[model samples]
Target chain A: MKSHVFRPLLVVIGLVVIVLIARFFYVPSDFGSHEKGYMYGWHRKGNEDEWKAFKVKYQFNNEYCKDCHSDKYETLARSPHAVINCENCHGPAMEHPSDPAKLKIDKSREQCLRCHYPLPYPTSGRANIRGVDPEKHNPGVECSMCHNPHKPNLRGMK
Target chain B: MITRRDLLKKFVKTATGVMIPLAAFEIIDPKKLFADKPFKTDEAKVRWVFLVDTYKCVGCGLCVKACKTENEIPYDANVTRTWVERYVVTKNGNIYADTPKGARDGFTTNRIDLGMGKKQDIKKEDIKKAFFVPKLCNQCDNPSCVQVCPVGATYQAPDGVVLVDRKWCIGCGYCIMACPYGVRFFHPKYHVAEKCNFCYHRINKGMKTACVGACPFGARMIGNIKDPGDPVTKILMTERVGVLKEEYGTKPQVYYIGLDKEVR
Candidate 1:
């Protein structure tokens, strides 16, 4: 190799070696521990605990209630309230399986009013809430008195 | 014409000049320089789908409020990551679409007190039909937002959630304009492109999106479509679901059931 060209080539090789050594020292040994691909190395921080902790604040899904309340679960499945999850009204049932009394079953008039309350929203709107003016319809009467939440069609009226 | 001593001094000066910057850069650590970490989850292993049951949405605005609070969106800004539109079609074929405060505050049609003049006059007898449709980032399979991002800051994760790397985003607003659904917005405080990421930080941890969680009615749902046993797959297979702007070919992950013919 020519002397001038050889010297420049040697310098370039030496620089690359230095860079590699520097990288070895700088980069964390476990930097890509959770990485699935090379294109992106930074994975979102947090183990499974982050999501698990967040979910506990919300009501558990209907499937969890089905394990014990299989009869009520089956009945609700075929009823108009089938779309409603068990925990939506009963609250989160996470502790119910372990301690049966932990489930707070709310059978209040205010609970039914959440969806069925009188509002000016269009009937064709999503949810199509058939708004009922409580004062005129049934004053001081609980919703469950007239219509069963499980089967809202008033099956027992006959 | 330069002397040998002069040549050596010149070479040494240049060498020092190059070495100083190199040493400084090396110590700074290039690996830590990355703006954000890539998604660690295996893409093919997860197929996320968002199901919007328009027939079930009550227009209560709880989802919108939940999203704003969870994401810490600016309260005063008009921009929204998600919103609801109440479409009222008059009997005379006149259509009026309005979203009061992006539905962050629940809607009320009683215009007498709200000072919405003449809307009350045309209402009771002239209205044909009305409904509420919630809107959010579609998380398109072929997202234009991702395509227009000059920095590659907006990208689709392997699990198919479209995400924005705030650290990497340049706030160019290209992604905001590129979106067909008008989901992207420049956050007032952060000065970055912002939109619904399907609550990725929460979903990554196996929790539902904040909006979905806040919905009192079963109006919103999320599931892995790739799983045959997933309810989303079964619903998609069974329901007469529709996507927004199918002609755009974005293949939006959000599927709407009971979407009216007039809804865009």
Candidate 2:
């Protein structure tokens, strides 16, 4: 009888319906909303673009700083520090680019010591950044004693 | 001797029973598993590349600290986005390696307190040659981490930087194990796989990576390799570069200059 075949088909259909309903709940509606060309073809669900919008809160580029401090920028270009960005030590200048007075120039000794502190590393290392032990090299004296911050090399400046 | 009306009624009942179950079972479609929504695809504008001059690295460890601070990573935690390794070969053909706190506080041969010290005291003069090699995620052309992530949470961005979606990550360590370089780790706080993203947050803003910016020596270099005007690109074109584990065929984007044969 046709009823005999229909009974088996009905059971199979019941199982399929349960699986389909489970999938609908398990799979998120927005699975691939943000990840268009990313790896694994999976969409990024995080605030991946937050850095793009964070520009309004911070700016670290040196080009805008060069606008107002062109003379210093010119000097830096001629010195060994040419490649270093101004914001490395001075912090982000997003506000300073607009209001020049907002720029915070850090003249602390810690700033200079960050790069110049002496560590007993291998002599063969080619940093070209001559390190000095703070207490032994120039005890109680400021780093600006013998070196110019803008042009550290006396021979190069001359 | 059955009536026509009775037979018709039985046929109708059987058909309804079959069709109702069929409709329910047909609801599961495999296409839905891979169905992707239309999103704005950002074109690959610049392919960023990072270069390390192994001969020039002084084991300063400033890059590690800078990365830690930039990424707001805790100093004491086992998680490190980047680190450096010092490879020392003794004259007697003994190999010694150590990276205390990932060399975040620099390295010194005088001290061997990282619990990696040898049983025999080897004098410094007995060492044949030693050098520091900085390590980070290679950002391979064919990264295995991307292939193993079950949820597709870790992926390479359009700019060619491998990144992790912390929000979507189910704390699965598959990507961590998939990386052959041992660069990936599970963040203790976020509970997700974390690796060097090349500081995409900074690079996207047209700024150098935290490690590159922190290096006092011009040992670490990064730039858009595609742009001819980029100085880093010029260096890459001129220098004879090598990648770690080339046999793996990962095709890592990070190139190294003066890489010694001993380094793995």
Q: Which ten residues in a row are the worst by lDDT in model 1 chain B?
A: B109-118
Best by DockQ: 2
The per-model lDDT (C-alpha) reads: 0.69, 0.70
- List residue ranges in candidate 1 displaced over 4 A: A1-158, B1-43, B111-121
TM-score of 2: 0.68
TM-scores for all candidates: the values are 0.62, 0.68
lDDT of 1: 0.69
Q: State the C-alpha RMSD over the true interface residues for candidate 1, after superposing those residues.
A: 7.1
- In the range A15-113, model 1's lDDT, one tens digit per residue, is 976776676665444333133232322323232223234333333366666777798888887886686666556655445656546766667655665
lDDT of 2 by residue, A78-128 (tens): 887675567655654556656655666555555565456543334336335
Alpha-carbon deviation at B181 in model 1, angstroms = 0.5
DockQ of each: 0.13, 0.20
Residue-level lDDT for A87 in candidate 2: 61
